[model samples]
Target: MNTMLGFLLIMKAEIIRGWIITRRYWFRTLTGLIIGYGMLMILIAGFFYSQPAIEKGINQLDDPTRATNYILGFIIGLFAFGVIGMFTQGIQGMAQTGVLEQLCMSPYGLVTNFLARAVVASVTTIFYSALMVYFVVISVGGKLYFDPLPVIVLLTLSFINLLGFGFMVGGLVLVFKQVGQLTIIVRMALFALAIFAREEFLQQGWLVSALMHALPITDASICLKYVLVKGQISETGQFMSVFLHPCFYWLCASCLIWTFIGISLFKIMENYSRYKGTLGIY
Candidate 1:
């Protein structure tokens, strides 16, 4: 009970710190929002420009539902990028500034500290993603089906899944300290996967399908699309169908498995780095 209380206090402190940082850098935050909006506009313009050629190859952008799918996927990709960045870039920044060792010395330890940070980052990421998605959808005249309950549930699960993946990458960072290129590659892969992953991909073959299900983002993207794009709620206005879906189960299992793997890997790598006396080395 004391451990849980300590964890909660750590979380509260991190949240307060995050709020202060954002508030202190208000101009920077506003600029980021503007930049994000500009980039989103550019992407939409490019999609429109390529619609003709894309139509000939694949009839993907002809309908509102399809457009919503693409937008939602892009938003999810952005969320994933932000969450992962908190681990990759955040750790690197701490290491470079020589604060990494100080954090490791905290009473709560590195794992608890980082987990608290992840929670704060996830909350901010979700807020920003939702804000951006809302404006983009309005600008594009796209209609998305949003049931508050299911959307919140799926988003929470997706956040957990991404957090796990972030921990894995963060573990690598603790040992490597200069995995910028590798992190970029992984981020790009996740971004592309978020945009293209669909339920249909699960029908390819057992091996292929297994691989899709194993990814942290694949089932998440699919589940969100079902709720947001396909309107998968039942006639009784319940999400029982969504709850019963195999992908949903996979998402739950994936969250548990990946989180365990990530935390375990992080602990192993953390110990190895400490043993090598390189935990503070940038």
Candidate 2:
């Protein structure tokens, strides 16, 4: 009871502090969301708006499955872009402002600092996703078959998944000094792979599933569709798949492991920065 309040207060402080820093670097964050939401909604509009024609055009599966698949594909596309926005902005902010170092000076652990930035970024993401859904409603001209409650749940889980990506990318930034190049390639890959190009994208055949599962983004997409489009949150399979998802949890666990790694890397850089006298200034 009392302990939970204390924890909440501390988390609030961390988020507030991160929020302040965010104002100083507002362009990248704001521009990212704006561009992301704009582009995504346009594509989503195309898909749902075109679905009726697609179903009528093909005599294959009658009505519902065609529409269902269309909606599922849109959900994955949106989530993939969400991942790109999250990791891109996350790594950029850490590398640009050295916020990681600033937060490290505090008594709070790195995990708190890491999570705070995630929350701040999540504020923007939440807005964008809501707007996307609203746009989806406008395009489709209907409400969901079931309550949207399950999607909200899956969205929260997806945020946890994003945390793992943020930390891993931040780690790369710290070690490599500029992972900017890899960011582009990763962005393209996420779009191509998760945007519904393939049916068994992350979990198909043994070999393909093995490869896709190795990347957390893959399972995150699969689980996302299950919970969001299908309203399968109560399913044992969907929930269990989350725990087994490599990119989402296994790597998320690794992020906690890498917090220590970040500390060690920061210590080494601290020494070098002190010798070079560039630690605090830049």
Candidate 3:
């Protein structure tokens, strides 16, 4: 009970720290929101409008409901990016600033520290993503599914899966000290797969489809799109069906396995760093 209380306190402190940082940079935060979301909306809207072939292939863009899928897919994509950034780059930032060693020395542990910060960052990311998605949908004259329950369910599942990937990246950063190029490749590749992967192909038992599913967030993205756009609850169905569905079930299993592997790998790296007495070195 005491340990749990201490952990909670540490997490609370980390969350408060994030709020303080954001508040201190209020102008930068506000500026990033306006410029980032505005530019993305213009780019996406213009590209689709210009590319008749792509637009036709995707179906009637003028149809608000049908367009929701495309918009929501980007939203999920942003969250996936967030998961990657919040862990890998989050750790990288600490290491560069010589904070990782101090964090590692904490009695509460580095994993808890990273996770506490991540939880707060995830909340901020979701809020920004949702805001961007809303305006982008409106810009394209697309109707958004206003239901929060399904969206929350999708986000919860996606976050779990991505958290495992984040752990893996964080572990890599712990030992390597620099993984910027690798992270970019991983992030972009995963984002592409999540945003534009063909559902029909993924349903097939092809090697490519299998590979895509092996990556975190791919299956969840499909399920999320189904829920957000097609008015479907799960890509498969409701209740037990949600659990039984290949997409959801595989995602849960992958998250559990990856998370385990990631934490174990981080422990190994942490030990190695301590042995070398290089925990503070960049």
Candidate 4:
């Protein structure tokens, strides 16, 4: 109980710190949002221009599910990067500014401090991502079926999965100290997976399907689509069908497995870094 309470207090303090930083740098935050929105618009324009057939098909269809799915996938990719960035970019920045060493020496420990930051980052990213999704949906006239319960449940799972993946990357940062290029490549791969992964991929082959299901975002993306875009709820409007789906179970398993692996790997890397006296080296 005391440990949990201490962790909660740490999270609260981190949240307050995050809020202060955002408030102080409101202009920078707003500028980032504007730039992000502009980039998204450019991508949409390029996509439509490059694929005339898809554009025409979207025009002809009343629902435009394909377009909606594309937008959702983009949003998911952004959320994933944002969550993971809290560890990758955040740690790098701290190291460059000579604050990382101080953090390593703190009584709270690196893991506890970083976890608090992750929680705050996730909440902030979700808010901004939701805002962006809303604007994109309105601009494109896209339709989405949003049941609050399932959406929340699926998003929570997705966040947990992403958190674990972030820890894995964070572990690499602890040991490597300079993995910018590699992290970029990995994030790009994850973004591509988010956009294109689907249940149909599972039908290709067992090995291929297993690998896809093992990815952090694949099952989460599919589950989110089922609830938000596909509207695969029961006749009674309950989310039982979603909970009963195989992908849902796969998501649960992925969350457990990835989280355990990520945390364990992070611990190993942290200890090695400490032994090498490079935990705070940029």
Candidate 5:
């Protein structure tokens, strides 16, 4: 109970610190919001505008509703990427700023503080995602089929998998002090998994489809697109359908497995860094 209370306090402090930073640089904040979100909206518009061929392809599926599914998937994926990247880059930033050494010596421990900051950051991402979605839907003249409960549930699961990925990155940063190349590869892989998996051409073969479905964030993206753009609510009263679905189950299993791997690897790297007396080294 005491530990939980302390964690909550730290989380609150972190959130306040974030608000202070944002407020102190309100212009930068506004500029970042405009540029980042504007770029996303513009790119999405460009994709659909330039590629009427894709629309024709979806029309071939006899599902006219899919006209906007890819765009929506990209939006959701971008949101997820932002949330996960915030955590990963926060850890990396600590290293770059020589804060990791102090954090290592703190009573709260590096992992605890990192997780707390990440949770706080992720809480705000929900609002960011909603605002982006609202603007995109309005601007694109697209309809949304929002089932709040399922969307929340699935998105949370997806982020759990991402949290594990963040842990891995954090671990690497602890040991290597720099992983620019690895980071790029991981980020692009995530982008592909989340954004490109929606392509029907990739659905060929049992093995290929299974692999795509099992990829982290892919299934969640599909289901989220279904709920947000297609109006298909599998169930709200019962949780069984969400769990029974292949994508959903894959998400759960992958979260469990990857989280275990991530934490274990991070712990190992943290200990090694400490043993080497380089925990503070950049």
Candidate 6:
């Protein structure tokens, strides 16, 4: 089908996006290897490192809450680096390499193209979170037996939520430290939770609690915590809906809104540049 073909093309272009950045830096081969495996090792180590604290909190609790919180904290914590984590350098790399312009000029399927780019990097977040658990097991440490299905579903939901944010930030990169800063801090906070979060972290602080509810991530992260921690298998569908159903549709809507804005801006800038005969000046 034509629709299927379009999807394949989008995936093809996005899968190779990192190579473009590496080529621009003349570090294609070297950086590829580093990003490829170095990222995995760090993810493994982070998960491993955070397990003790997860278990520590678990031990202090009476029964199931201990296991529940540890699992919730551990999984949701890694959410810090989820798809949003790829932006750590992916955003900068794309902008610096002038890929923003290139992306806007695609032949067709702009949303699919951009989503592919976002998903490609989002893999790093998944890597780090899974490794955390793997390393803990290898070290002969306290390990929580998590049901993989829920975690996978939660991870998928979180990644879809971030795809929208990535698109909106594209045009603002020229002068947008505030958004970038906020992103970094949120990433750190989430990663911290992935390691271990206390009730004090989730319940007591008014500011933190407020932010938790307000951020897009709070939806899935909480869903993950509840399903994993509370043993609420029945709530899984609702939690998945809260984040995946509406969030993805919103993300898709955002992509359309953002791409429209981006195109409008480009046209305006192009016309102005043509009048001045300085198109490449930017």
- Scored by lDDT, the top model is 1
Q: What TM-score number comes out for model 5?
A: 0.84
Question: Across residues 185-232, which tens digit of lDDT does each residue of candidate 6 receive?
Answer: 766765664545333444668788655444445555555654555444
Q: Residue pairs in steric clash, candidate 3? A: none
Off by over 4 Å in 4: 52-63, 233-240
**TM-score ranking, high to low:** 1, 4, 3, 5, 2, 6
RMSD to true structure for each model, in Å:
2.7, 6.6, 3.0, 2.6, 3.9, 7.5
lDDT of 1 by residue, 10-94 (tens): 8898888888989999999999998998898688657656765865424444455677778888989888887888888888889
Tell me the tens digit of each residue's lDDT in model 3 across 105-204. 7887877777666777788888888888878787778765455776676678788778878887777777776774479788887776766754685767
**Tens-digit per-residue lDDT, 1-282, candidate 4:** 654665688789888988898899999999989898888867765665566687575463334677678778888988887777777877788888988888777676677777777887788888988888788777778778878988899999999898888888888888787874478777878887887778888889999999998889999998897877778755467655588888999999999998898888888888898898777788
**Candidate 2 local lDDT, 1-282, one digit each (tens):** 544454466668757776786688899777866786576556654654566676544442234434344445555545545554554455455546887466556555444555554565576556666565555544544333444554555556555554555455544454454564576676567555554533245446779866665554555555555444545433444433334434455434444544455445545644554465443332
Better of 2 and 6 by lDDT: 2
Give Cα distance to truth, residue 262, candidate 4, Å. 0.6
For model 6, state the Cα shift of residue 99 in Å.
Answer: 2.8
lDDT of 5 by residue, 128-202 (tens): 667776776666566787777878888787777777767877787777756733576667677756665553634
Model 3 — which ten-residue stretch has the worst lDDT?
235-244
Q: Local error of candidate 3 at 272, Å?
A: 2.0
Error of 1 at 116 (Å): 0.7
Error of 3 at 267 (Å): 1.7
Between candidates 3 and 6, name the one with more favorable lDDT: 3
**Sort by lDDT, top down from the best:** 1, 4, 3, 5, 2, 6
Error of 2 at 183 (Å): 1.6
* Candidate 5: segments with Cα more than 4 A from true spot: 49-67, 199-210, 233-244
